[model samples]
Each structure stands twice: as structure tokens, then as C-alpha cells.
Target: MSGGFFRGTSADQDTRFSNKQAKLLKTQKFAPELEHLVDMTKVKMDVMRPWIANRVTELIGLEDEVLINFIYGLLDGKDVNGKEVQISLTGFMEKNTGKFMKELWTLLLSAQKNSSGVPQQFLDAKEEETRKKKEESDRIADEIRRTRDKESRELEQEKLKKMLASAIIWVHVLYLKTAVGRRCK
Candidate 1:
């Protein structure tokens, strides 16, 4: 019978021990904070899920599953300390929630390129189109008003001229009749 002993590498053992120690220390230091953060994040995510889903899917034209996967990828990143940190989409809302949300919203807006949160070029183009349409409409309305005013002024002038001519003719006839009657008397 041969004596046999199985031995693993010391480096592997040290790495495993270090990882476990690091995890333990992290939990000890931030367990309460982590718990609270997770709870709050969960609540927020639940409340905003429907609206976010609708905006991402209908407005942004992205699939709900794709958005979920993208967010999950974002959350599954390592911290600066090189610890294996996992932030679930439903939990762990960090202090940068607003920033991350804004970034995601911007990404969605970029897909449409419309005015409400679009790129500068797209916004400018949309504004230009609206301005041109409004200017055209205003021009048409002003032209119509000017035409109508000119027609009204012409009609008034013609009425005045006819009245003046009739008055002068009546005065001349009355003067002639008076002169003829005086001469005859």
C-alpha cells in the first residue's frame, strides 16, 4: 500500500480565502446601508416600471426585453475596489439613480431625433420646418386681408364720387331754374 496525499496549490487557497475575507468585510461595513438601498431601489423600480416600459417600448421603439437586458448589463459591473459587486435592476438603487436614468432617457431620445429631447441638429430642423409653415400661413392670411381692404376702399371711393356728382348736377339745375324764373318775372 502506497501513502497518497492530495494537495492543492497554495496560490489557489490564498485567492479563495482573500475573496471570502473581502466579501465578509464589505458586508460587515455596509450591510445596513445596502439593505436600505436595496429596499428603496426596489420600491422605486416597481413604481416606475410601467411608465419606463411604455416610454422605452412605445416612444423609444425599443423592446422591453432589450431594455431590461441592457439595464441588467449596466448593473452587473465591478466597483473600483475590484470587488465582485452585483446590482440587480429591482434592487440597489445607488445615489446616481437620477444620472443613470437621465442617460438612459437620452439614449432613448436619440433614437427618435425629435424636438422634445433630441440632438441639436434634429431640433433645429424641426423648429425650422415649424417656422416656415407658420410664416407661410401668416403670409397667406395677410395677403387676403390686404386684398379685402383694398376692395373696400375702392368701393367707398366710388360711392363718394357718385354722390358728389349727383349733388353738383342738382345744384346746377336749381340755379338755372331760378335764373329763368327771375328773368321772366
Candidate 2:
């Protein structure tokens, strides 16, 4: 009746057997498998490290050590749940190298498109020249307007002077005729 009919052993023996079973269980957990996985990952990383470093240096413009440090920092970063998980930089690189290269090319293409390759000083000089040309055009327009206004005023003054002189002559002639008529009478 005792626990599957193995009641031949005494309570002390059973206790010893239980203790040994517990020890075996504790030792047989996933530790060995986890260690093997870690070793395999390390070997893979060793194989890929140089290639990854070269790509990062050539495409991303980072030194090998700097890139390694950055990758390690990212792998050590915490999740949104505030839990830290281990990551493999080599595995990440293996999976994303093509994507990284595509992004790098896109960035270079955009930069080439946006940049005219002109020196900053030359650009500034060109802008200043344009401003000066505009100012010169404005000055010439203003001067023309002033000259036209002056000519118009002078023409108006000449017309008034001629009208005044004719009126004075007419008045003098009329006075002479009235004087002669009175003398005759």
C-alpha cells in the first residue's frame, strides 16, 4: 500500500532515495543544454566577427571596436517590460546585413542628390551678387521716375508763362485804344 508497492525499503532508505532523486533532478535541468547552445553561438560569432567588422567599417564608417561596443550596448539594452535579455550581435548581423547595406546605399544616394558639391563661400558670393543686381535695378527704376517727374513739372511751368505773357499784351492794347478815342472827342 505504500507508494507503488516498494515498501521493502525502510523509511530511512526511502528518505535517502528521495534525496538522491532530488539531487539528480536538480543536476539534470537545462544547464548542460544551455551551455552547449552558448558554446555553439560563440563559435558562430567567431566565424562571423571579422566579416561583420569589415562591413561596419566599410559601409557604416565605424571602427571595429566602436561597432562592437555599440552592438554590445544594444544587445544589453532593456525591454519595455524592464527585463534584460541576452542578444547575439553576430546573429543580428547575419540576419540584417543586407538590410543594413540597402539603408547605407539609400543614405548615400540621398546625400548625393541633396548636395550640389559647391563650396559654401561660392554659394554665398553668388547670393550676394544676385542681391546687388536687384538693388541696382531698383535704383535705376527710382532714378527714371524722378527724372520723368522733373520734366513734367518743367513743361507745366513753360505753359503757364506763355499764357501769362499773352494776357498782359492784350490788356495793354485795349488801354491804348480807349485813350485815343477820348482824345479825338
Among these predictions, the greatest lDDT belongs to: 1
Candidate 2 local lDDT, 1-185, one digit each (tens): 65776647776677655664445434532212122111111122332344446666765555768666664344232221001111223343544444553443233233223345233434567799999999999999999999999999998888888888888887888888898889999
Per-candidate alpha-carbon RMSD to the true structure: 12.9, 21.4
List residue ranges in candidate 2 displaced over 4 A. 1-120
Clashing pairs in 2: none
**RMSD of candidate 1 to true structure, Å:** 12.9
Task: Give candidate 1's error at residue 69 in angstroms.
Answer: 22
Deviating ranges (above 4 Å) for candidate 1: 1-119
Per-residue lDDT tens digits of candidate 1, residues 1-185? Answer: 34446555666577655665556545633322222111122122342344455544554445657655555444332321111222232233344333345444343334233334334444567799999999999999999999999999999999999999998999999999999999999
True-structure lDDT of candidate 1: 0.50
